[model samples]
Target: MTALDSFAPAWQIAEAVKSGTVRAEDVTRDALDRIKSLNPKVNAFTDVTAERALTEARRVDAERDAGKKLGPLAGAPIAAKNLFDIAGVTTRAGSKINRDLPAAAEDAELLKRLHAAGAVLLGALNMGEYAYDFTGENAHDGACRNPHDTTRMAGGSSSGSGSAVAAGLAPLTLGSDTNGSIRVPSSFCGVFGLKPTYGRLTRHGTFPFCDSLDHLGPLARSVRDLALSYDVMQGPDPRDHACADRPADPTFETLTDGVAGIKIARLGGFFSTDGMPEAASAVQSVAKALDTTGTVEVEGVEAGRAAAFIITNCESARLHLPNLKTRPDDFDPDTRDRFLAGALLPASWYIRALQVRHWYRENFAKLFQDVDVLLAPATPFPAPLIGQRTIEIRGEEILTRPNIGLFTQPISAIGLPVCTVPVFNSGMPIAVQVISAPWREDLCLRVAAHLESEGIVAAQPPSHL
Candidate 1:
């Protein structure tokens, strides 16, 4: 678990630094070297702040001798999705339009929290343009290849975060999910990703994709590390209006207590049958592995998704009204047309979506009283071919781009907490979503940790490394 130990977890890395067996400088150097050697093939990182990262690492090591009480994540190297603001780095947000903007004057609020924990900021990761798309293809930075298979996409907006962490470029990463950006990539890349409750983590200085739907969370090699990072990142930031003011529970506690006695079920209906055999079967496999007895169908899921669409489009259009008016050409082709479509949505549709949200949330709450966790597919299919627009599932060619969120959108619309547990089959990875009640991030991670411990969900490294 020293800085020299590749197999050790992040907590071990920090403890090793504290114990002097692994210096912060050495660990940071290893991360930088790994980035230099592996990033080209992965295309995960948009920027690698080698000099700044090493400089910070050296400071952390020096502070140890001064007897400063280091934070829990101290010496852990974290590369954030480009959506997070890095001082001296322009928040390009995976867009060509923002390329000319100057670097931020200070670290973003989330960055500050991570830094306070002794975590090192390595650089900015590539993402879907303005985080509006899935399927990890970046017109500007190039596609982020799936670590498990080079030919497949890594799942996106948070695509680079998934690719980077799965490839071990960094042990921890920050990713945003409006629909399935964080969950999809985490599923495809076989990493633990937590899409915290809607307002559990602050979005301050994190580029806004859809004001009502956008959420930021962590991606890590292990469930514990995900909890560790979330521990530091979850809390209110005055700057973010959506940030909740409640205190945060120790994420580690929830994961360690285990998943026994929890009313767990497989969410059927649109969540399961919509295609994603590998992903759906993965859920059943995990449930059997965990001895889950509850199995239920989620009615009105498709309707919930329609409602989510209204909110996402209406909010996204409002957020980008200026750009859609002036520099529409600068957007990624996928999102450009989508934004234009959103710009034309009727105001009444948006209002109805709001009403739907209130109703859906209440209905979802009743389900939670019967079941603690609802297992669903993170992405209906595994990582697709880089440019694929359609996927054949059960004799039907489904729209690949938007279908990625088939199971995820409805759950997100209700602002629930969920975790993606990666399932591998025939050299490919698919993940199941572990959905919990709102603000119940603890329960989601707990179930995911149970699956991980049983070896149902394993984080396998890329071959040929």
Candidate 2:
């Protein structure tokens, strides 16, 4: 089958399916066929749920024929990072060790919600093992290459999530952000991604990475799709202790509320683009488009990033201690080495990290009181060449893996909502983070939508693809 206009936005696809202008099954088949054809080039999908997707699509058609009302995301194809449980599929979590685990008995809570909202499950996407990576190179599954330039990284641990959407295999995908997984991939692959406020989304059926810092969200081609996915997959879940017992506050309905009067500020100080010309240009372009000149210094941002690192290392190390003890050789060498180091860290470091988290959250709370939204670079630079270990910043060479999250970690550490908007300024695309106060994801998306409206940012199809 010829591919569905893979470049078409999710909202358009859903509207067509809902109006009977197209059949859901055909859309599913087109997506599956596209995955079969393009996935080898991109290496995005680890598993393709052809049979399951067709079945779901047919059900959607049947419901339409029966005059049953469909949900907001009617007939759009969606996939998740392999970490999310998908019923019979093994929750790989991008690790060789997880391949031996039994298949999940039920779909993840978010997936279930998507299913209810008429999203067909396309399959699972690749990621950095155990969600510990910034680059998309997975030792077990090979790298998920950037769609724009196959030679570059796709950004990860949500690597495949970003690649699939950019490559047009799927319109929307679910990914978890422990540090900058969603935002990094969004920046690198030139797509829109949201790392909703931590705990705003449930982690019940997804694999645990950094228990305290982990957050689940969607990456899409359009800001509205992000709002649609966010609206549906919310609400408290008993299975996840961190899931907030809050009402489902819908953002899609209120999305068109423009950012005219909203106070916006560019984050300065630690977020300055001292070494990354591409990142700096992207931010400046966005500031020009938004017509904002005001800048504010965020105190303790560097320290907050440090706390995020310590907390992530300790929590992930403890979670995988049993496997690290037994199947260390089976694990990816890079991930194993970090896990081992985390295992040896003193307990006091983790405690101090938690204390820092509280302090940082308080600091951001005060900052938000002055501005409704904050702007900053999502990643230090664009996608680096795959297998490139070090990047030059400020005339100093630093490891690429850890430093990619330099701008993102501090905001994520405080569990604030963020939407990374892709800005195409040079050969490769970079992005700017639109951050809002806790529980104010609506503000993040609103600012992102405004930028998109002004033609400053977009998820344009890659020329190479």
Candidate 3:
């Protein structure tokens, strides 16, 4: 690997810039060059902010030259999912309809925060249409190919966030997860992704998916990068009412505390079944590494997933009601039908779903009382072929797109923090979810970092990249 390749980790890049070992301009230019060479094959980046990135890099260099104190992510080149509003760029939430909308007045809240921490914005990455997909196939923008195997799917709606990080296009990228958007892609692309507890980060300026379930977090190659980005983005924002009013809870300080004395358990029952052998083995490997054979079952997990589906449909439909009435033709057919069905959902069903959600949350909170972290497969299996629809899981045929989030939905339903750590196999990479109670992201990161330290879980970028 070249010197530039050594900077693939955001933390390393930041430290290098901070110590005057490398200029931020050089780092930014190297990243942009990589994007130019590799993006066509991976389709990870939808936009490349070359000019803005150079400008920011030069500013960072100037600060360093003047001997000013730098931020934690100083000089890191990062990107955001296209859903985020970038100033002077039209926010296309993977749809053709939003292409004509006026450019954003300013950067999104998270982008502003990252910028304040001295992270340079590279550009916007591609995602599923309106953040409504599990596969990274965009009808308007085109499919985001997996870096591991270009013919395979990169799980979405945060498709490009995973692809970019895996391809080494950017060390850190922000993705919004309403269901498994963040985790699924991380699994498929062989990278680490954080889907922080809902409301942990402000959602102000991003395109809405499911307001109740929407969460914005980071995708990176290392546990420390995830913690660094997450710490930089945490804060209260009046713009997003859902954002927690709590002060920043930094995880970097405690990331290497180790998992000793922490009770970790594997999620059994529904999670153990209806998945390929690879998925089961991934979780088992993580469980074995943690030396925890104890199992905990979250009752009504299937029902919880069903409830999440109902809520996602209803909320997403509500957000697009006006557009659904005016330009339904502009949406991806799969997204359109789902939204239509959601719009037609009975009020009774929606209300009951909400009630069930609360009940599930209560039960999940109880589960955390005994266990500090829970382990589960991030996806039912590795990435399916790009265009293939059905997947055979233990002799049962299941539709590929919807079922990919089967394991993730139930956990995200109650808004718990989850860190998806990539687990490599002989074939493709799968991921295991390290879940913790709400607001206890520290615990999740701690466990994930421990696993990384042991070399049991690590990010393996594609050789072709």
- Full-model lDDT for every candidate: 0.84, 0.91, 0.92
Q: What TM-score would you give candidate 2 relative to the actual structure? A: 0.98
- The global Cα lDDT (0 to 1) of model 1 is 0.84
Candidate 3 per-residue lDDT over residues 1-465, each given as its tens digit: 235573379999999899988899999989999899999999999999899999999999999999899999999999999999999899999999999899899999999999999999999999999999999999998999999899999999999999999888999999989998999999999899999998899999999989999999999989999999999899999788888586789999998789988999999889885447888878878889999999999888888999999999999899899999999898999999999999999989999999999998998889888889999999988999999899898898889999999889998899999999999875799999999999999999999999999998998878765
Q: After superposition, how far is residue 29 of candidate 2 from its true place, in Å?
A: 1.0
Model 2, span 87-159: residue lDDT tens: 8999999999999999999999999999999999999999999999999999999999999999999999999
**Where in model 3 is the C-alpha error above 4 Å?**
273-275
Q: Which of the two, 1 or 2, has more lDDT?
A: 2
Worst 10 residues of 3 by lDDT: 1-10
Q: Supply the TM-score for candidate 3.
A: 0.98
**What tens-digit string does per-residue lDDT give for candidate 1 at 29-132?**
88888888888988999988888898889888989989988888878889999989898899999999988889987877888998989988899998999888
Evaluate model 3: give its lDDT: 0.92
Residue pairs clashing in model 3 are: none
